[model samples]
Target: MRFRDGQWLVAEGVRIEYAEEVYRITPTPSGKGISLLCPTRKVMSRGDTLNLGTLSIDIEAAFDGVISVETTHWQGAIRRGPDFDLFPAGRPDVDAKITKTEAGTTVSAGGLSATVSGKPHEFDVSFHPTAGGKPLTTLLNRSVGLAYTPAPSSPMQLADTRIFKHYLFTQTTLSVGESIHGLGERFGPFNKVGQKVDLWNSDGGTSSDQAYKNISFWMSSRGYGVFIDTPERVELEIGSERCCRVQTSVEGQRLRWYLIYGPTPRDVLRRYSVLTGAPGRVPSWSFGLWLSTSFTTSYDEETVNTFLSGMKARDIPVEVFHFDCFWLKAFQWCDFEFDKDMFPDPQGQITRLKADGVVKKVCVWTNPYLGQASPVFAEAAAKGYLLKRKNGDVFQWDLWQTGMGIVDFTNPAACAWFVSCLERLFDTGVDCIKTDFGERIPSEDVQWFDSSVDPKRMHNYYTFVYNKLVYETLQKRYGTDEAVLFARSATAGSQRFPLTWGGDCESTPEAMAESLRGGLSLGLSGFAFWSVDIGGFEGYPPPWIYKRWVAFGLLCSHSRLHGSNSYRVPWTVDDDDQSDEGCSATLRKWTHLKARLMPYLFSQAQACVGAGLPLSLRAMCIEFPDDPTAWSLDRQFMLGDSLLVAPVFEEDGTVQFYLPEGSWTNFFTHEVKNGPGWFTETHKFGTLPLYVRPNTLLVLGKEGEKRTVYDYASDVEVRSYYAREGASAILVDNQGNKLGKLEVKNGEVVGSEVLTGEFRITVVNA
Candidate 1:
């Protein structure tokens, strides 16, 4: 929402109200809290009766630590976005005082104060005078007040009649050097400084600027994060509408925002996650590779067995096998019944797979869509649990499937019905669900059973309900910390559902790199666990591409091999000629390596579960804020706080990476290098640059392992790299059930076995 036409004027028909001078200050009690009401006038009023004509703005604490500012005169309209109020919760250790000095009247909160001009009408807010002290990043002029108007009749047209009214807005006065980031799951660029972003979820691919998950929380280069806490649609003009200021406005009257004071970007996310919920810890097995029967790819018992047997023959240890949408009969998804054509005996097949040392966790794909052919469709339609059009008919579309009506998650009865259907699937030996196609919800002419929410707001939030239902159902069946979903779409607070993957990407090197960018961006936006399709999702990737992707995917928090038209099995892509080794060889090498690395990977995952941090960390997120070299690098990522993973994106095996201020050791080759600088190196196809920071202890699982949930403490090989004098490292089990502590003093490994397990320690120098 932009509102400016020029430097000094608001757009035509735009009403402006200014609170120039404070006429009167009175303290009043409302309910349980005390509020301060300050009436401001455009002109000075010497008499008390004249003050009655002025408008009053009420300020009070909404929560224990949050302050709410409301208008007394124009309080009819509902407020929307870009509202910042400074109110600290709990008991303040610092002082708060309103003092009138020669310069102005200042209100201070925790050593931070805003100076209101003493002059009659010239008022502005400024931060501390010194550079090293408290930083005040945002301020509102006297022109700030309640704004209300009609919504835009047209969405696509930029210049609608509503632009002149309250709907379309333009604002200016942004700082020149300010940079912006975090509009959840954005693919174009990691930094969103000058972008015109629309806060709407879509099924756009990695090449375009559009995003699957859109969040209105962004951290500026000036050291503050602005979180627009609204589920509705929000349009943001970040240093775009006006070159100097960030202008954001929504369609409603009530606007609530939080200006998170972060001296650094990491602090901002830490505080933000505290406000919203933090990501939960998923089970260790989820960290291993997951093989899926690609969408639209023909597969039966024979095809499934071949892929499994080929992986085993290649020594690629696969933990979970997912069956795509075709698992159910055509046109009857959510039927939760496996297609007899694919597998005549689903139970017998699952038992056989489990007997082969493969824990059979089948991924049955389902959406909110209920086709007319589905048995539950008529029941939901009759029970008023499906979304309906304005004409009082159930909203049906022929997009993915014929006559598919979306399940109305807003209704409690509808969620129960949906969960019941999934519960039945779980009972029939089905392990997990690929909760797909949540981004295509219709906003217009749609009515939810819960009429309290706006239709447009529910569009993005629909994924939350859809994933939550399936996740909760699984948790109830399997217990907490064991539930997972290979979800596609998401919004704020959706990280509670453990695992989400990059949706529908093409089979190209460019798409592969973009997919990594999307996952990194999503990880930065507060999602802890994420994965992308190994090879690709749309077409058959070449053997070289597939083999390279296998290494990358296996390293992810969750790994899956999926595709659209062609099979993703290693044998299908490997060349038949003698010049190249079989696809089975490529799969065996990476899969076996992933299995061996499970102890180290799962240990890092346990830390992610304990702390609300990402397993796959972006460079800046883990490195020092003062390190200038780390700010721009995006191609590589730190696997956790300890190790840095630089995947080879090009055909040639050359890789470039930077190590921040420490002696680092290569995890694969055991080569040590002194860092705090950049390094470029070449490698073979089997190995990439994976380095561990100095004074670090890594627990490597035994060679040729099978499962992620093993005795991590037993037979664990602890490799201690560049351990300085008096330095120590600790390794804990998956549930934090066992502790393995090793200490290094004077360049010697002083190992102490804290718990019962088989372990070995390797000490290396930089």
Candidate 2:
């Protein structure tokens, strides 16, 4: 994807043509946009324009504070399918005006404007805030171009026969102190400068450059965001190629992108969700702990019951019990049938688990692949429900299973059939489904049921349709605000699904930090809910690591205990010691602590659903955009808007975190500290660095409330910390319905009518 060798010379066999001059500018009929004719070279005369290529650039106002720029080299190429589902809810109207003066042409819309320079032989477009300040970014001369890259393995000796792939590229200026963040669940450095990121979904675990979710949107620390509008392959050189600009390139005839201007970083996220879709509403029960039967481990009906029973005896309530891939027989993943030999009766077992109150919900794992060993594969292949090759044969691969064919969700019959399969599971008392492994979809030599979509474009977009089908099915079965998904893969608009988890990771402190980085990055990308494997998913975590991860996982939006080859049950991992710092004890402590936080957590979640903000594990930069140090700190995150959590990443529990200018009170201990500084502290396994920010009112649930789903407005304790005028807290019930608000009015805390049922008011650091 890099075409230059240190900026002085182009890479071998690469030809580049820069857009040198703006020949003409014409306003569109809609009066909301302008198009520019840009030639590849300076047109000295009419003869200089002969035998040359011209680039057409269109700038349109999308909505408030958003404008799109599309550059095209060939305007006659056939437009393809599988485009992103932008503005899925509806498009908002904008107030736009196009004016031309002697100086130049400027199109202003929604407080943001794009101005085109009128100087001859100078191709310059600058985006600025309408309130009059420095430009956000500028596309200067030599910034827009097209390149011809030689095909792989082209012989150097046969220059006449070499083939080339064409691409359209644009580079936008980057300021000196601007930092870039978000590229869909990136596990690398949070600041993406000096990194070349390819937005392709892959299954490479948390330790590598491969990402399961690759969203083509990023926010700049300078308070603007850019969303590349393509599901096809996109390569971004964030200050890596030119060191002064962010270069974005895509193969094919045209490249379109939108620049969203937000006076604040949080406003940028809100506008992003308007273009894509807002995150779906999640159920309150999902905030509780989820226990999974590890993959490839020995698990039958008895084994599941024993794990549940041990947790119950240890006072660690498992809200949702998950059965991993072995629920179905080997090599028959999408069969959707329980192994009769292992379980004997799945419905009866699921009924007993729920009826006996051992677990409140049951989740089973499934994928979009149907192996040939299962009889259902033949039915699907015969009925044209599976993806086909160019020659009308089913596309089969042996990566995860033998002769596995992907289910074509693009086909309506296939989607209906998959719904029937899920309906059968719902009949068996299963409440949730873990939609896993949609990242490895084949994109070459494949023909989808919908023939209009390009195969290469469907590579990263496959996860969106797959997860959307399953999530909609769940929504139809369970009413509004009740559907949830533990999905593994995602793209731009996949945030419409309720929940997703971090993919495979190792059992080490480094992996834990990587999970945090990925979650924070994804949160920046507009995903509202995220989870991770408690003790890691690859190896058996030691007791200390397990206990440390338990404290961190319980604080996520959703928490799950899972592993690869070993069980994540507390007793199975910890020694027989029953002290307060043991694995079981630590798990019990955090589980109950989270239960006590349900009142505040559910309200935060409800707010996020409406505003398109992350409810849990929010990056520090989003909360404190003016603080320079907050943009680079990734080790800690804000649980909601009020509480800050720094996960202990060391074996000795030594941790360091930053706090903005405010008064912070320790949540575990009542000690108060004044900060706009960094602090380091050490503790045992029972606690980590958790603090409450200033000017906040925390509505806490009862101390001994064990269940996550209960009447949150009843029997709650209201804690006011440094309460200031105009400060308030919104309250909601278990079903995410607004109850009332506790507002600080005239220096007095007054509650609305709905804050009923024996509430106690406690003051902290007042």
Candidate 3:
């Protein structure tokens, strides 16, 4: 997308038009706004028709705002993509008319205005009325905007282009100290200033740069977020383009983006979530540790029993037990029928687990792919519910399953067929579905039921339909606040589906950290709840890695122990008889701690569901923006607004963490630390640094309430930490439905509300 050769000149065959002066400015008929007409050339002849050509320039506004500029030529045809802005119109608060004087033209919004100097084909758009604390005006430079002629013989590409096809681009100037962040579920470095990113959703594993969820939005260190309002592909050349600018371009003629003006990154996300709906509240038990049968692992009734017995013997409370893909007979995934060969008595097995005080929630793996052996495949194919080739044959591929054809979710009948299958699983004891694999959709030579829509766009959009169908099915079968999907892929608005997991990561510490980065990025993108394989998803994690990941995973919105080619039983992976020290003891320690902390963790999850906030919060999102230390720290994350969790990423359990501008109390050790600085410490496998922020009331559930779905407010203990003068804290129930509010004045707990739980307050001296 970068077109400039250097600072002085444009590349060959490029045309540049500079707006030298504003010829005229007139108020619209509505009197709400005014448009500035700038002529590119300077000439003085009476009645001379001025056609100075099109202007190539950059345009931007404060975050949570929008800017519109038009560049049209007589020759090129205007191509448009899917129409957006279907919801509502934004209102402009500040306005000033553009006035053209002999010197220049000036138009204003807010207290800010720009003046174009009167010169022949040379003008600079500079901020005007440089008085007071007016909002900054963005200058459009040469490299920031451009218009391109399409190649003469390239075939027309639409929604289904695998990656980006042809694109017209513009690069925005980047400041030397500026950094980029937030592109949704990216596994790369949290800061994206120097990266080349493509806005396409893929099923690529967690080890690679490819992401299952790709968002065309990014907030800059300069305090603004730019979100391209397109479902189609967008290419972002972040600092990669001209070294000083972030360049972005789409394929079509029309380009529209919203500049979300947040004085802080958290405010930007809050505004963005308001535009796109915020995440709904999930159930409390969804926060507890979930144990799953790893994909392709040899597991049956006896194997499941052994793992459950071992976990209990070790006192590791498992809330949900998941059965992966093999629960169904091979090649008949969507049938929703349990494999009688493996579980001769399905009901008995479920009943046994339920009786064991374990909430049995089977993780049934499914995709849009319907194998030929599937019972509903014939029905779907007969009703034209399958994606078809150009020649009208059902599109079939042998990727995961033989002769697998994707269910055409666009068709109402197809969605019904898919839902019917899930309803049957719900009818069986299956409480949840691990809705996997919407990433490898075929975009080329495919025909959707909605023929007018492009397939490339459908690739990501496909997950929307896929997840919605499953989620809606569960909601219809169960009820509201009960439907959740372990969805693997998503696009814009896909946050409507409650829970999604970081897909298929390798069993390594690097993969574990990468998964956290992806989840953090995804959280910023609008997804509220996320999970990762506790021991990673691919190979067996070493004991140290497993125990560390267990602590990290249990703190996430959802936690599941899953893997491939190996069983995830702690004893199997970390056996004392082997050379390495077993993580079985470590797992036993943290798992019980997580279970004990369930009262606090579930409350945090409820808060996320209610406020559309992320359960695992990045330090920058919660800390003061002026604290430079918060921006660079990503290895550790705040569990909620109160608790800071620094996960041990290394073998020796060393963690370097920062406390932002406060007196913090360590949750495990009753020690207090005054901060606004960095601290490096080492600990045994038994514990890590889990700190509570000053002036906070954290609720702890009563003992023996092993399940997360208990009446949290009934027997909750409120632990008050470091309540500074004039500070207050509130303890919410498992639903984020407020339970009690507490305040501190003169270093004492005050403003206590009626409490139904066994609550206590601890005020630490600063």
Candidate 4:
């Protein structure tokens, strides 16, 4: 954390010792082996043996182009732990080379270099553009420090003994113009320069700085990413403390971080996806609009039917129907059995719903919690499948429900028990699992099935194993491309599970903007696909808020309409517009608009999987990194490299956004604008600022398609907006099956690649 109060003085009781001298360096392999000694004080005489605060550091390479820097104070301290699922390169052949000279040693791979100094007395790693470059740019900047503060001076501890905690920290330098971003799905601000982020997942709502998903990976504008490899609590100050360095501290003797070198932000993301895992391809139909049964609201099969029928009556295409927690009885949550009172013929009703004119997928809510009243709770507890206290009792608490016990995902049999529960729902026509509530995992005196891992270490990491078990079950039953989870909590590699949503936002415009900020922050953190409750998640959204959010929701990678305690259906919550059918009509329009754009959106999803790009959804900086103005633009985002979507975030409908150096054409209107400047405009709830990039051919589905799951090539149209003479685009359908390539060459069109579908070209006046 922060040691100094402001700039000059250290806090009263805080004791800090920084690495003062580099003792020696023992060098080994090309990219793998190295060690250094960093003393807390200069070694002038042998009297220094009394208090040796010397830190031992091990530097090595992982995978192809990644570095692991581990610093330790007490080598034998017992607190080691649960790390994220990192995929290291299995000794691949590359151009990486490490050599030692008279002064020090150097390691170079691809276009990156890290230099280590021996005689210069520095335990730091200095990174630069080239091995011989004089302009020493960004590098890991801090000395390994040992910190101790007397455990709070309360009366409870005054009588017993003196106490202190051992902490270690490291800070990395930020270049002059560097802007720090990403630590997880944060809501406060996009540029994390002035933020103090804690990498601990919480159940806090989206309206605050507290995040449901807290990832330890942060990427900088200087084009490198750092991952703090700890599942326990980690605090980072991104320029808030020092105003220059990104300082990191964890509550243990050991400190480990992964330093990723990317010359570009995109390159850094690709490298990050390789280190963690890439997200799988979500099924084609999942790109459509989804509607959910609001939590704590009264609902059953009849309620679901009415919601679906209302959508059909208004011609709003809904692809997935979700059942929230009350789908099971109140206190019997996570029993994996549907409430028979509300849904007597669960399987039959689901079958009928799927048999409708529009194909629909069913998603049911699930958590790792087992209430004591649940029929399966005793079975799970008896089988040693629940988290236990140090005294061998099941760790039960009265939090969300009575005597709730967390499923011990560390045990294979426990996971198997959870998987069987999910399989029962899958047998009843359930297609996706809304994996919720993994942020409240216990870190106290608890025991795990795999006793080797400390419970403290599994606090944030518990979500990974929990989500993976359910996701693997989905992948096993359905194919790889068909599995999806609307997960709310995640770690670094949790992006491997597709489609996480922003959690518990209120029904207001500010909350909507906060969700956008969280989603963009998550994108920067390497989450592949993200969704938000269309009308916010907490209360009754105003009609205009719902309609405006509808445009933004439909255009995202995944869209859903959900709320906290009220129905999010258009007609039900439109109090201000009761005199008209405006909400229903607007929902119908935006819902079908997403269906028509399925050809373009699904192709982008395929690119996320096939290429290193995990989420085609991007922050503006990801696309326009060279533009200095784009790094700070968080309100607007590039929707899959082509369309720039700036969702109107206020009730007054006023909009102000930037277009970074492009010829942008309005998607709804044919108006074109020259960018590299700011624009202010006002519009009603029916529209938003969805601008298509210049010179790109939009591969679109046929107009008025009832469902989104059709063969994208059947009646596709490649529409061009201000087509440049040499600009071309590859056209693909919802399944990413190549239809053809459209090019404007030599002032004339040429070539045909479409095999079975009817293809046509239309030009829109820009």
Candidate 5:
């Protein structure tokens, strides 16, 4: 991935051909783009072009505020399948024009423009605002080229004797003080400087540089973003290979990317959603507390009922109950049959729970792989629905399950077969699914049912297909607005699936903060809804830690309590079982608070889906792009446009958070503070710092609301926080239908005719 050793040296056995001169520039056939032919060397004589390599570069407008640049070494390479499904909603029309002058050729689309220098012996592509300002980024001389590993001795080498791999790469300039973010659920540093990020989904937990969701997009602090348009592995050296440039390299002959101009980070995200797709809308009931039977824990129908009953005894409502991997018999994962020994009647249990109002939904764990021990595996293999090797044998691995073969979603019959499996689950009273473990897809020496797909490309793209198929099936069964999925792995367009959670993490404070970082990174990458295991996933969280994480997790857009070796039920995890301020009490308080806040939260969720913004745990940088300190803070996040949540990471409940220049009102204490500075505070297990921004209207549902599904328009409290005269809150019903708006008029809160709720208005800091 890194071809250069330093400023002036190439890595050993790596051959590089740097584009040195722009030999020719012509308009594209569409007349909306420019094409360039750049030779590796400056041609001083007519014969100098005879035996030199030339890089073909094309520049076009993908949409408004987005420009595409594709560089290729060989034009004859066959294009493969498994490509990204860009513009899934449909492409927008753009006003693109080409202008050629004596200096260069500039292609302008919307307000973005790219100018390529026409001077001989010089190669430069400068991207800037069409209205004219500082350039966003530039590709200088020797920045675009082809690289070969284990360099061939000569050009005349025979094809059978040659043993080498070639790569196409591009390096773009990074402005001073610029930081890069969002390579998909990254858990390392908040900023991606001095890091070599390989875009491949992995099963690595929260402490490693590897990520579970490896998206190919990164937003820069300099008001622009770059999206590598490939499903294959893309290695990015962000100021690591070259101190002043971000280098992107991919195996094969071609590499393409989109340069999106935002003037603002939020604008950049809005444009990105248009290019890929906006995040899907999740059901409103999913916003409440979800209790799961922890992985590897001894859980049966009795244990599940006991946990739900325990929560009910403590005044905590479990909106959704999930059964983790042990739901099926051991060694038979995708057989889709409940373990009869554990639960004699699985469907009856779900029915009883829902019938008794104990839980609203039931979710079960599944993956794209079927174990050989499963009877369904033999059926799938006989039906040619499993991935096969070149010799036509079913591919098998023992990493997660013995002889697990991946379901070949590339085949239509295989997809239908999987759909039938899901239909059976749906018929058995399962409401949703926990689609897990698509990150470990094998791409070596394997043959897909669709032979046109490159194995390497299918590695990360596998999650997209796997999740999309399941999501569509859910939408077909449930209504579009009623579908939800707790998926683990993802690629670029996987945001189209409703919800995804941060994968396995330790039960330490550091892991909690890292999980927040991962959610922030993913939020910046265009994902709308994200969650974390309430008390971490690997081990038992201490009472204080569990209490603290309960507050944090419940505040996420989607909350789920799950763990690996131990149950995450609050009563079981709390050390002081008799104390009133224990984990169970904390869980109860936060769950009720989320239910009360649903009026505002659901409205904000609707806005996020419409605008391509993250619903919960949004990075401060996205909302406060002008604040330099906001870009570096990852421990704290803005829950929506109004509230800022700083989770207490220390065992003593100490937390430090920043508020941009504004008057912030504490939601709990009702105390107001003016800040453009850092504030540290210590809280008990019951509460943390939750602040309301200035000039905002905060809405709340009925007090002591138990269930998440309710008439949000009825029995609501509208709180005003030193808001301007025009400040308002948009209201929606339990079914996500727009009702009306409540606004301030004549110094009083007034509602439109459609706002038929019993409104109680209170001014917090007015």
Candidate 6:
């Protein structure tokens, strides 16, 4: 994807040409539109026009508040099927106004205005914020083009694409001092300014550059966001391939990009979420801890009971109990039936677990892959419910399971067949399903149910369709507010399904840091809730590493205990370790803290669902973009716009984190510090750098409550920090009822209505 070696030279064996001259412009018959014959060379008299279908540009403000720029090469090619449903599907049609002047033609849509460079030197499509004072942002000045490799005369040459090697690419400048922030689940760094991110979802673990969820979108520090409206492998060179430009390329004839405007980065995400769908309302109890019988580890009904009983005996509360892969018989995955050997009476066991009071929520792992040994595989093949190749054969693979055929969610009958499996699980007392392995979709010569679908596009968009089927399945059965899934794969709009987790992280400090970065990046990308493996998914973690990660996991929007070869139960691992002398005690401490704070967490989550506030679980940069220092700090994050958390990533529990321009109050010690700078501190396993920003109000349940589900308004405490004039907070209970409001005037905290539920209030440095 990197074409340039430096500022002045292109890489070896690489050839790229850009659009230069505009020959003619034709208007669309329906709306205000202009299509230009933009070739790769300057048209001087008629001698320079030899090659055709090299490049063309279409400029239109088809939808209100959206500017659509489509650049094409090899025009009039047959279109493939699996493209993203962009602004056209969900928004109203607004007539764009075109005004021609000597300067250029301006197409105005709402407050956004686009000026196309005209006549003598046809070059740019520049945009301005006419409504606000925000500066200009350009889509492409002269960077739209086709890039390809010439067939080599040398023997070392390799074939690139079966179709013509030409691909569509566009580049736009990033202003001086501007920071770019997304391309989802990127674990390498916080600022994506100098990163080459290929939007390919792969199973390469968290230690590498590969990501599980690759959404082709980015938000800028300049108060706007850009979404490349294509699902075919979008290669993003953010100030990396070519300096000062975010170069986006896709392997296709046409490329579509949406330029979204907002006065702030948070507002940009708010508008972006409207283009795609917003996050759904997750269940209130999903905020509590989840314990799983780790993948590849042996487990049965006795093992499940012991894990549940162990947490209860230690006073560590768990809400969701997850059964990993072996819950179904080995190699017969997605049988949708619990292994009779492990669970003799599956329905009875689920009913017992829910009634036992220790574990009230239950989940099972399910993927779309149907194994050959499964009872329903033959039936599915007979019914044509499996994905097929162009040769009319089932595309079976032997990677995770022997002879596994993928379910074609795109087929309506296949979806009903898959939904029936889920209904069978729900017929028992299963509460949730962890939708996994949708990322390893095929991009070969595979045929989809929709005959016009493109395989390359479905490689990423497959997860969206897979997750949507199950999310709708749950919403239809359980109602909108009660549905949730512990999903492991996603795309641009897949955030509509709540609660996705970072997949396959190792048990190390470096992986822990990357997991946090991935979560923060996903939050900024538009997801409301996320989680990761508690200790990790790989090998057994060191005692100190396990203890540190537990604290970090408990603070995420969702929490689950899982691993690959080892169980993540604190006491089980602590039995053989020398480090983390208080491992069990530390796990208990954090679990109890998350349970008591469910009132505060659930309140913020509900508000985000009702009003489109871009998910409360956020990176500090998204919450405090005004502070330049916060833009580059990836090790820490701000929860719900008020609480700041710096997870200790070292074995000794020492971290250096920034507190952006505020009087930050530590959540544990209630110690207030004035910042806009960095602080270095060492903490025990029980404490990390969690802070509450100045002039905010936090509603918390009772300090020592053991159960996760409770009347949040009852016996609650409202904590006020640096409460000054005009600073106010409203308390909403778990059931979406307004409890009371708190206001501060002249450095005194006052209740608006003598707060009916849990009148206990604490003021910190007010």
lDDT of 6: 0.81
Task: Tell how far residue 218 is off in model 6, in angstroms.
Answer: 0.6
Model 2 alpha-carbon drift over 4 Å, by segment: 151-162
Screening candidate 6 with a backbone cut-off below 3 angstroms (N, C-alpha, C), the clashing residue pairs are none
Ranked by TM-score, the better of candidates 5 and 6 is: 5
Candidate 3 lDDT by residue in tens digits, 1-766: 5455676776554444344444555554444334445454544563443434433332333222333333322225434323332222243344444566776655444433455555544445544332334333344545333344332222243233353333445555576677777788899898887788888888789978798988777776666566677777778878775677777776654455555655577666666665555675566667777888889988899888888888877666777788888888899765667889998987788878888865545557777787888776887788998999999999998888888998888788878777777877776677878888888888899998877777777776777778878887877776777777888887766776778889989999999889988887887776778888888898878877888888788777677888988888787876642232356666666655666676677666665654556777454554456776666667888776788888889898898988888788888777888898888889777778888888776666665545556665566566777656666555566555666656667666665555565656554444
lDDT of each: 0.67, 0.91, 0.69, 0.80, 0.91, 0.81
Candidate 3's TM-score reads 0.87
- Model 5 C-alpha RMSD vs. true structure (Å) is 1.2
Q: Which residue ranges in model 5 land beyond 4 Å of their true spot?
A: 158-162
Task: Give per-residue CA lDDT, model 4, range 141-231, as digits (tens).
Answer: 2446877776344535424434667688887776688898888899998899888988889999997778888988888877778878888
> What's the residue-level lDDT of 639 in candidate 4?
77
For candidate 2, write residues 65-150 as lDDT tens digits: 99999999988888997999999999999998887877688888778999999777899999999788989999998899988876
Candidate 1 per-residue lDDT over residues 348-463, each given as its tens digit: 88778878875546667888887789777798899988899888899998877788888998789988888888887777677777888788889899878876667878887778
Candidate 3 local lDDT, residue 539: 82
For candidate 5, lDDT tens digit of each residue in 1-766? 7998899999999889998988998877777798899999989999998987999999997778899999988898899978999998999998998888888989988989999987767999999999989999999989999988887778765264347888999999998999999989999999998999999999999999999999999999999999999999999999999989999999999999999999898899999999989999998899989999999999899999999988888889999999999999999987789999999999999999999888889999999989899888888999999999989999998988899999999999999999999999999999899999899888788999999999999999999999999999999999888889999999999999979999999999999999999999999999999999999999888888888899999899999999999999987886538566878778888999999999999999999998888988799999899899999999999998999999999987788989898999999998887889999999997789999999898888877776788888777777899988999889888777888888888888777565455767788878
Reference-based TM-score of each model = 0.87, 0.98, 0.87, 0.94, 0.99, 0.94
Which prediction has the highest TM-score against the true structure?
5
